[model samples]
Target chain A: MNDRLTAAERVAIARHPQRPNISDYISALFTDFFEQRGDRLMGEDASILGGVALYHGRPVTVIGTRKGKDLEENIHCRFGMPNPEGYRKALRLMRQAEKFRRPVITFIDTGGAYPGLEAEERGQGEAIARNLMEMSRLTVPVIALITGEGNSGGALALAVADRVLMLENAVYAILSPEGFASILWKDAGRSSDACELMKLTAADLKALDVIDEIILEPGGGAHLARAITFRQVDEAISRHLAELSKGKQLGRYQKFRRIGTAVPKKEGQ
Target chain B: MNSIFAKRRARLLAMKSLREHYVPVGSAAVCPRCGKESGHPAVAQNLFVCPLCGYHFPVGAYYRLSITLDHGSFRELYPKLAPQDPLSFPGYRKKLEAAQRKTGLNEAAVSAVGTIDGRRCVVGVLDSRFFLGSMSSAVGEKLTLTIEYAWKNRLPLIVFSASGGARMQEGILSLMQMAKTSAALGRFDQRGLLYISVLTDPTTGGVTASFASLGDVILAEPGALIGFAGPRVIQQTIGETLPEGFQRAEFQMEHGFVDAVVPRNEMRDTLSQLLRLHEKGGPS
Candidate 1:
């Protein structure tokens, strides 16, 4: 079982009882793919993957945190825990994509940002907060795909986009279920209950207006058929980019400025 | 009878001599008759003030550090990076200079590498006498640097926070330090390092919101005031009076914001014990 299989794989497996590999369906999805690395401050953060790629012939900035297939890679990437530099690197790429008037696409999948003293000294929280502020005002279309766990401030730092799409199996919340359980119940074993209460599932997020779209995954999850999952993600990305690009001039970016509105209180009759 | 009276008088005089020799420095400092100077130490061994005049003198950061750290083991770090008023907020620079002159400290905080009960640790102690120990950019930078240094050296970090919160003269930049410092502490946690925060006197506002409250074990000095927003603001917001001891160290301990309340006298021992226990290799 390939661990790198994406949401598209799950969708593909759902459509076909006999699941196929995810890489097999990728050729039909994306047009051009180029990998970019290094944060320009310290060094490259492999946990966050970004590149200039063509999605259905349209140039786009593809950003996502990659979880390794094996234990060694996971350890190297700190289990997808981004550092302050990683967020900065992501912001740098986002700015570049905006400069060229290309749509920014981000994939979220991480526990949280690295919380080490060195990271603190380097101003990790400020970096994350800065990204949130800057991304909110970016003058180009930005789309986010929560392909896996969207945990805490780390994910929110990059997950701020014009349209947020979540896979049916993915989860998004202010904190991890385990973390919430630890804080609220003082027991990590209560994570399943905390998850339910947090309403972190993609379906719940969509229902709460927290996510714009919910991309369906194949039955029994995406790892079963990676290629089909990529196709599904590709289709969703193309459709969103096309819709956002139309009549979207310089001022049009303001439309996404206020996408989510808080529910208003009602006055007594 | 005359000889007997003289012998008794001689014995009384000897007893008086012995009592004068053992009198405390505080009691001997002031003459009871004329309020004139008496030969005694004006400041006691514990840095307590004169018993007669009740005059209090400011203690230097070094003296405080000495009392907190293991004997003869503290090495000060980054003493040169003092505060510079970037905002030019009226009289702020002058206030900083006056504080520096009065306290004989370069800035509000004194960061040092020292051993507490043989366990190596990095400590940053905030002096309330220095501009109310407000956290300006220098204080923030020093704290951040100290934490980073601790992480690099794989040492436990201890900070004694005594602040009036963010330096208002620095404005938004000062507020930004809250985020900066918090992020730095977050990184420390990532490295699985121990960060012990000791809140002393008054630690409020931005400092309380940031790293001050983020310690793995948060201990507070008895009678310290620790809170995010002041009680007055909270009361106004909620349109009700706060309960007694609101925002005080005891109140926070009761509310679970503080781990324990330690007296100033026992702080060193408590901290040393905590360091020893943490160094014994418990789960991170």
Candidate 2:
């Protein structure tokens, strides 16, 4: 924890092009990755990549918001921003995970839910709402990892997990610092100052009890040492999953229920 | 001397009448959308809707309850629960205090158990005046408690939402409120109790993506703006002119997000009808 990176620096690292993405994590951490596609209600959204896979020889459902590695792919993935279908697809896979009793793991890396004409037309708000309600009650252990930029409800649509973890350099917030700055201060250029105020870094979230743990990245960043980052993530998931596999539904409820500062406790019976 | 005193009294009375004629005080209601002004009493009689253009005024939490609920059938809950500056975020405490002072609300939301047409239900209204009805830790706590109360008491739930989304001042804790409230609703949903969400003008952001959109039947007032992202952000992102009526209540209904665009006057009747229909026995 020496010479900690500034919040803005963390945001930059989180969005760094060379940083490891879901594809890299899926390939490095799991085997027998059978890629799934389509929301069944609409066309497949490549922004959210999900499928059943073998995790340490155990079958688990893996889902993540994917950013394209190149320009052409970025167009295909919409720079990792998901539409309603992407969220529905993730929900379908999570429901499938619940049915099969497979632990669900979701990797989050997105600016937010896509803010476009089509996304709104298709109940973008409802899609994310359904995910939050359903994921909160999932019978199986669910783990969400913030590997990079976890912005807005898009990151949260897939992140209502029993245990939410984040990479050392990852940033999770209600919205991006730039967006936050623009909305609150009416100036996007003040994003660096906004970053410091947003409390978005992994360490900040961890202290606030917003996240369960922080997966330590190698010196420089996860992009510099992908293998170390992957290993840390793998161990963290396994540890949390093992503990969460025992009666996790109520624990998930209590974890979020007790989070508020002004929640009043129940009176005498 | 008596004639002089009478003249002076008449002059003071005339000045008082002139002052009352020019200065309307809080007795005037100005329609922001239509740029028309009406007497406050007339607007109140119309359920706070502009008589000329039909624009619904943003009603506060208590005003919403007073208009919609059965007389003397409301009992407030958690009236004193207030927010703590958990993160000690800069200016957050002052903002909370200012919002509290301005709105007379402990938090953005007011939770209660009330009746409509004598049908008991748990009700909550988010006052946009209170920090833009943004969901902070306390607001979320109040909502979750209200939902859970409905679940436990076998009562239906109705929430009138008018939020700008999660409270940014509370940071991530405010974000987690979306999940907490939704989680409580998830449990309430399993009980088979009806949850009616009435979105007022400008329900967007994290609130819309959570409990506001998770209702069994989603309703919106005429011309309410409902969406996950604000229109400005979307416009800035796409760099294109948006379609007219985009994200409006009618637009949302046409897009199949909202079930109906109920007018302010008809909202109470519609809710009462829905509650009666969902009642245990046959419609009475």
Candidate 3:
């Protein structure tokens, strides 16, 4: 698939017979899929897609960013760049999943949060930060799969999972490679080099200890064979869920609490 | 004929001598304290002050960071994330590129993780050489990442701020970084990590309104300009002459905006003391 396409173009490509969206295939594979929206604060945000569903008869919360299938839909979804409301919605769903003891699964895909003035006025940064803090303490097992471009805080807002998985071709970073290139070189043309240096590719992230696993994508990427890609992702999720279910209660809380504690030790230890 | 030529030459020579005899009327170039020329480095170094009138130059960020960190121990972070012209603003890219080339740095700020007297701390120093060390996207991102890194590694954060304000070339994005950076700091605070902000010369604009002022302990260099707006702007808006030294370090200290105005020579010791105090009871 062409990487330069806007979210609309990618959605169109997914609609083609040669390429289907991962969400479409997964919905078909799962026995039940239900979507819930809004944080009851301001209004509903279409950028984040969330709700509970049954994966092979096991209840799970499925959340991901959606770019929409058409221009109008993209406009409604804001090209999947969420706002404060969208993050709040995701948090609400995650908290609900914890309450119900359902495994929370999130598919990461976004260029970052909406940087619009309204978003800022409504405290988008606070919402994203709050999510990071809250997710670190949530009691249920959480899994995140980077299905596409996971860029900036928007991706991180929904990506504080116990185990973070990424597709072979996906990219995940603190910021997009193009964004990094623009900042570092004052030229967007250096995006390829930025990608290499940022350690954003799934393989790179796995090596950096930034990601836990890399699910194999079908030859030519998920855009080429959606069914195969979906099956691979489903299997990966299942395996992780099974392993996580075993330690669901024992030291799980402490494991999440101790995620980033690496203070240097004093000398002469 | 020889006598006449000699007479003319003598007259000309006498006129030139007359002009040299007159004393030039200008201020004498004498040091009040030491009776030496001003602008000499030795004079400035002697009294923790200037060689001439004993006036002290404000310490820059590099010197501050070095004094605060343990000798020979500082590892810089995000040195490659420089500023860019995101809006295609005229002359902005050229200015940023030139600043980077001149400073041999990617951005206005230098972020690093180093040991402060054998205790690990995340340190950032903002050089005022690059566009007055403005806060652009790169600076903001570096700061945010530094805070997050500190939070992740359970390290304290210390930043020396010397800025003219936000990078105007980035438009509203620059303003947005204020919130983004503050949010990151908020996360760090929630994690019970200590963040100490050292405000240096000319810390102003959006930076003062955000992370620079949000530190758990706000320290400023003696005689630094620390405010949200320029004195001239405030004076013009108020239609009156502002108070002398308004917004200066002393004034800000009086107004309770700054915790202390430590002299340049004593800043290192003060910061080290603060770090040791915080490290003793800081979050594990």
| The candidate that achieves the highest lDDT relative to the unseen native structure | 2
Q: How do the residues A65-175 of candidate 1 rate in per-residue lDDT, one tens digit apiece? A: 766656797777766778767888898999999889888888887766665533443555446655655676677888888777776667766766767887666666655
lDDT of 2: 0.88
Could you tell me the lDDT of residue B218 within candidate 1? 89
- Candidate 2: list runs displaced more than 4 Å: A1-3, A246-250, A263-269, B1-26
Would you list the C-alpha lDDT of every candidate in the order shown?
0.65, 0.88, 0.67
lDDT of 3 at A245: 86
Looking at model 3, residue B244 earns an lDDT score of: 72
Distance (Å) between predicted and true CA of A169, model 2? 1.0
- Per-model tally of clashing residue pairs: 20, 0, 2
Q: Please give the C-alpha DockQ score of model 1.
A: 0.02
If scored against the real structure, what TM-score would every candidate get? 0.46, 0.93, 0.53
* Model 2 lDDT per residue over A148-179, tens place: 99998899999999889998889999899988
lDDT of candidate model 3 versus the reference: 0.67
Q: Which candidate is the best by DockQ?
A: 2
Q: Candidate 3, B130: how far from true, in Å?
A: 11
Query: Tens-digit lDDT track for model 1 on B89-139?
Result: 567778888877766667788788877777789998887777778777778
Q: Which structure is stronger by lDDT: 2 or 3? A: 2
The candidate, 1 or 2, that scores higher on DockQ is 2
Best to worst by lDDT, what's the order?
A: 2, 3, 1
Residue-by-residue lDDT tens digits, candidate 3, A129-224: 567656766678888888777776677778767788987777766555565666557776776655555555666566545677988766556777
